[model samples]
Target: MSQDHDEALVRMVNQIAANLGPGREEADAAEGVCTHLEKFWARAMKRRIVACLDAPDGGLAPLARRGVERLAERQAD
Candidate 1:
């Protein structure tokens, strides 16, 4: 994906995480973000976001990163 696309994906996941983070435990928020991604995001989008995990400065927030990690695990299974 292009850098712009990657950045957009990062922003999107970060937004999702932020929206889900408030009023919830860390694990629950992460799970919610992961579930949203799994259920709503396209396969290509999910793969791209998960690839961001490897970028040194992917710009993903803590919750977003955790959520993406969970999504990756699900994809693996």
Candidate 2:
């Protein structure tokens, strides 16, 4: 994906993490974000975001990173 697309995915991941993170434990919040991505995001979107996990400057928030990690694991399964 282009840099712009990757950046957009990073922003969206961060926003989703923020939206799902409040009033919950970190792990739970991450799980919520993961679930949202799995259920709502397109396969290509998920793949791109998961790829961001490996990017040196993906810019995903900590929670977003965790959620992406979870999503990656689920995807691999």
Candidate 3:
């Protein structure tokens, strides 16, 4: 995806995490975001985010990073 597209995806994921995170623990919110993404996002989208996980400047929010990690772990199973 283009850089703008990637940034938009990151922002969207962060927004989901923020929306789900209110009044909840950070870890719980991240898990919720991960679950939501896994169920709703396209496989290619997930793959793209996973690819960003290791980038030096992935630009992922803390919760977004955790969500990506959770998603990756689930995919590994």
Candidate 4:
């Protein structure tokens, strides 16, 4: 992905994490992010995020990473 696209992706994920982080357990927040993304984001968007998970500097927050992982695991099932 282009640098701009990568940054935008990171920013979007971070925003989701932040929105869901308040007054919730970390695990719950992560799951919430996963559900939100799964329900709202396009399938291609989810695939792009999953593909970026291993990038050395993908710029995903910890919660975002967890959310993406959950999304991937669910997709695998």
Candidate 5:
């Protein structure tokens, strides 16, 4: 997808996160969702995301890589 689509999807994901439960704390809800995403996604798309991000070698890089892997996993499954 193009950058625009990517951004839109990100926004959509954020929105999905925000709308997870029926409550006034939508922002908080989204944050919780995003947090889960970070964990799951980090493991899911570990490689592609790191390459796309051009991340340097480091321990923190796995989070990004796994996030990308998660995206792929989501697509395939």
Candidate 6:
């Protein structure tokens, strides 16, 4: 279960990086993609955290918190 969770996170991060594009630049498309990803990720993360609030799996609370922390950290960067 832990492995599955880790893999899911990796997949999401990989997809985000892939969408970031060829290189870091000031191009409109790249900027738009970055902004879109940030906004979408933030909203999704917020929703997920709320949904996970009462999850039965006790171990998931910390993991969810970590995920949200990581998401926020990435957004800050």
- The candidate that wins on lDDT is 1
Residues 1-77 of candidate 4 have per-residue lDDT tens digits of 67687678778988999899889999999999999999999887888888788799899999999998999899899
The per-model lDDT (C-alpha) reads 0.96, 0.94, 0.88, 0.89, 0.44, 0.45
CA-RMSD of model 5: 9.2
Residue 31 lDDT in candidate 1: 97
User: Which candidate order results from sorting by lDDT in descending order?
Assistant: 1, 2, 4, 3, 6, 5
Candidate 6 lDDT tens digits, 1-77: 35465445445544544555445553543444435445776565444433443445523333333444444455557
lDDT by residue (8-30, candidate 1, tens digit) is 99999999999999999999999
| lDDT string, candidate 3, 30-50, tens digits | 899999999999998998888
Candidate 6 CA-lDDT value: 0.45
Question: After TM-score superposition, what is the CA distance of residue 52 in candidate 3 from its true location, in Å?
Answer: 1.1
Record all residue pairs in model 6 with backbone atoms less than 3 Å apart, i.e. clashing.
none
Error of 2 at 5 (Å): 0.5
Each prediction's RMSD to truth: 0.5, 0.7, 1.1, 1.2, 9.2, 9.4
Please give the clash total of every predicted structure, in order. Answer: 0, 0, 0, 0, 15, 0
Clashing pairs in 3: none
Query: Can you list the residue pairs that collide in candidate 2?
Result: none
| Regions of candidate 1 where Cα sits further than 4 Å from its true position | none
Order of candidate numbers by TM-score, starting with the best = 1, 2, 4, 3, 6, 5
Decide which is better by lDDT, 2 or 5: 2
Worst 10 residues of 4 by lDDT: 1-10
